[model samples]
Target: MLSTIATTIPRRALCVRTLPISQTRYASHGTPHYNEPSGYLFGEKPLPQGQKRKREDWELLWYYGMFGSMALAAVGLYYKPDTRYAMAFIPQLLTALIIFNPASKLGH
Candidate 1:
């Protein structure tokens, strides 16, 4: 019964049909070459290569103020009691010490 059922199914019916496509396709738009600009851009000339513009007085003052503020803030944070490592750990250690105090009369 299995052989008769298999023979009834056509081998050609199992094949898939594919559409025929051309070998080459091209778009109808866009240039094949690039257009290069010939002059300085936007009329603002840049400084010559390997040369840096001198810093203005205001720029120097700004740099000093910014770095000075950062240094002062760092020093302030360093001296702050709450920011100290030992200070942060003191509260937790004190709680534990109070609960386990050797001088307590509750137990030996």
Candidate 2:
């Protein structure tokens, strides 16, 4: 039935008409203003070339605290007279290493 109907219509009528090219570009409805790049990273300007971004004091403290706690936990677990603690330490260390690795390579 669809084939018969399609055959009755001329090929020109079946073809879709192309829309006229718009000469003036304008933002569509909903957005009131068009945004242009201000060359900023996260609202702040990016660092000059060849300059490394310094870590904040709190970031250093956080990194130290996380690793220090993990190390202390591993030492405690290792010294405890149980096979389970020994078994758990391996996975805990591996998990910490996996999770912590990405933070070191964040800017690259």
Please estimate how well model 1 matches the true structure, expressed as its whole-model Cα lDDT. Answer: 0.72
1-108 per-residue lDDT for model 1 (tens digits): 998778767554556575568654466346645545557674446789998867667998899999999999999988877655687777678778686454567754
lDDT of 1 at 74: 100
Per-residue lDDT value at 3 in model 1: 84
Candidate 2 Cα RMSD (Å)? 18.6
lDDT of 2 at 83: 68
**What RMSD, rounded to one decimal, does every model reach?**
12.2, 18.6
Candidate 2 residue lDDT tens string, 1-108: 999788878775759786779765666566656566677865667889999888777998899999999999999988978566587577678667785453366567
Q: All models: lDDT?
A: 0.72, 0.76
